[model samples]
Target: MTTVAFVLAGIAALIHVYIFRLESLAWTDPKTRAVFGTTAETAEVTKPLAYNQGFYNLFLAIIAVIGIAVGAFGSASSDDVSTALIHAACGSMVAAALVLATSDSSKLRGAVIQGVAPALAILALLLS
Candidate 1:
């Protein structure tokens, strides 16, 4: 049970890191910018929003990574704290998925698949 939990949470954290990398690193490149469906003008226009959102995601991912590490490796005394932090991360992920879905329905399919998967993951952890 413990190993399963750690593996799942660690994968989630790593995925978050990958997402942050996509948002922060990839979008900066002119070539990758096109993949984001942004023209040069639009990219410049939404630069601040993109930058802020990327930063927020980076911090969120870092928190999630810490939570996973703590949950897996921290002492028994810190279990509750680690769980609480991961729960917070889960909540944030759900929120972010919703926001993405609503704003970019094409990218994430607003609350359908995107929201469902993470919600299920969080539920699994909670109910386990």
Candidate 2:
């Protein structure tokens, strides 16, 4: 169960990292704009906002990665710290997704994309 939890958390972290890259580094790129359903002008205008939001995602991913590393490789004494980190990171990810979903119905897909893995990871951890 621990392994399953960590793996799912890792997957969620990777997704967030990709999101960070898209929003922070490629928000105005044609492909990124297409994926986000934004016009080039809109993407350009919103680039600063996206960059800031991207860092938020990056930070969450980093937290989750830290949890995974501590849980998998750190001494047994650190288990509580590892669990706390994972719970906090995954919980925040879930909350952000819920906010996105509630803020706009059209963003449902994006919310699901952002939340599912973290939700699963949380479930796995709880069950474990």
Candidate 3:
């Protein structure tokens, strides 16, 4: 169960990293704009905001990855800290998704995309 939790957390972390790339690195690109349902002008105008948001995602991914590494490789003495880090990271991801979903009906799909793996990871961790 702990392994399952870590795997799901890893997937969630990877997804957030990809999101970071899309929002930070490719916000102005046509493909990224289309994925975000933004016009070129809107994308350009929002580039700064997206860049900041992307960093948040990246930070969350980093936290999750670190938690996974600690949990998998660290001494047993560190288990509690690793679990807390994973829980914090995944919980924040889920909360952000819930906010997104509630903020706009159209954003439900995006929220799901952002939330699922983290939610699963949390559940798995609880089971463990």
Candidate 4:
């Protein structure tokens, strides 16, 4: 369970960073723009949804770091580490997903990643 959490959290961090890049000037850089299908025009007018995504991602990265740090510090109990981190991560995901779902309704993957994965992860942890 810990391994699964770590891997997913790490991947989520990486992906969120990428999303941030796309929202920031990374979309302006030709080299960076190629990967995300963005253009300079977008750099001038960032979408609200994208900004929200970026903001959530920033929080996600911080939460992921906290999760790993707590694990390393030997505080994986319910009241201390595991419960707090998992609950936070799941909550972040749910909020992001809801924002995307209600705001845009186009970024299905964003909705799923942010909305669905966290709840499912929590359920899995409970079952285990």
Candidate that would win on TM-score = 3
Error of 3 at 105 (Å): 1.1
Cα lDDT tens digits, model 2, 17-77, are 9999999999999999987889988998999999999999999999999999999989999
lDDT of each candidate versus the true structure? 0.65, 0.94, 0.94, 0.62
Residue 117 miss distance in model 4 (angstroms): 4.1
Q: How much is the lDDT of residue 96 in candidate 4?
A: 72
Superposed by TM-score, candidate 1 places the C-alpha of residue 13 at a distance from the truth, in angstroms, of 2.4
Flag clash pairs in model 3.
none
lDDT of 3 by residue, 1-128 (tens): 99999999999999999999999999999989877889999998999999999999999999999999999999999888889989999999999999999998888998999999999999999999
| Whole-model alpha-carbon lDDT for candidate 2 | 0.94
Q: Could you give candidate 4's per-residue lDDT for residues 1-128 as a string of tens digits?
A: 76665556556655566666666535456675555456767754655555665666777767766775666566436335755786687667667778778887566666776555565555555654
Instruction: Please state every model's RMSD to the true fold in angstroms.
Output: 2.7, 0.8, 0.7, 3.7
For each candidate, give its TM-score against the true structure.
0.77, 0.97, 0.98, 0.66
Enumerate residue pairs that collide in model 2.
none
* Full-model lDDT, candidate 4: 0.62
Q: For model 4, which pairs clash?
A: none
Clashing pairs in 1: none
Cα lDDT for residue 16, model 4?
A: 63
